[model samples]
Target: MVIQEQIRIQTRGRNTYNITGEVSEAIGRAGIETGICQLFIQHTSASLILCENADPSVRTDLERIMSRLVPDGDPIFDHTLEGPDDMPAHVRSILTHMDLSLPISQGRPALGTWQGIYLWEHRTHPHQRNVTLTL
Candidate 1:
């Protein structure tokens, strides 16, 4: 079975927002008996990842590590058209991912109990983001 769905999310900015529930709900609605559900983030300034949902601190640490690894305002970056976060955003996206394919079984996404989907907001300000689901 093949399924297509789109979801818009409003971010507070610069953080990972858990979106597992939304993706799972969309998959359920699609009624795909068995397949792989692919998730694509329609933006370069953001990323997609499966993260530990059991603890909020894990997300926090991830953000901190990413920030340190690709801190804003590096002297070598030339794509600062948006701001310091612009180049940093690209770097973060490079380190992470923009699309993910998940196993779907029994009309549900096969996710571990403690694993969750996240939209890693790389921008420095709040904005609306698009999530496309394809199964």
Candidate 2:
């Protein structure tokens, strides 16, 4: 059997928002004991990731490194219609991932002890993001 659900996430600017519990809840509702859970973010400037959730500093360091690698307002980009963060956000999403696939075991996402799912908002302002979950 296959099940699909769309999860709405509101992000508060450029940061990673954990969605592990939400995803697991959806999986539980699906009643699928063993299957593959696929998540897809339906946005260009945002993405998804499975990262270390044990420490908050990991995410902070990631932001620091990404800012250095793709600084906002870079003069090289020509798609600044949405402001300085426009093109950079798209680049960051491209560098990360627009989708993720995880194994579902015993009616839950089989994530490592320190692993959690996150919605990486590359934009600098708050916005509503949509993630489609398939099982």
Candidate 3:
């Protein structure tokens, strides 16, 4: 069976959000015991990632590194109409990912002990993000 659904995530700006529980819930709802669950973020300014969720410091360091790698308000970007962060947001998404595919076992995402699903918001302001899950 193929099941598809979307979840709305409200983010407080550029940060990694742990959506592991949400995804597991979706898998439970789907009632698929041993399948694959794919997650896709339906936005250009945001992305998805699977990373270490055991430590908050990992996320903090990632945010810091990303900011340095793609500093906002750079004069090099031409798509500045929406604001300095607009173009940088797009770039950040490009550098990251738009989707993730994880194995589902016993109605739970087969993630590692230290791994978690994350929605990486690239924007500087809060926004409603939609994540489509296919199981």
Best by TM-score: 2
Model 3: per-residue Cα lDDT over 67-132, one tens digit each: 999999999999988899999999999999999999988779999989999999999999999999
> Model 2, stretches more than 4 Å misplaced?
none
Each prediction's RMSD over C-alphas, in Å, is 1.0, 0.4, 0.6
Residue-level error in angstroms, candidate 3, position 97: 0.5
Ranking by lDDT: 2, 3, 1
Clashing pairs in 2: none
Q: Please give each candidate's TM-score.
A: 0.95, 0.99, 0.98
Cα-lDDT of candidate 2: 0.97
- In angstroms, the error of model 1 at 24 is 1.1
Give lDDT tens digits, candidate 2, residues 1-135.
889999999999999999999999999999999999999999999999999999999999999999999999999999999899999999999999999999999999999999999999999999999999999
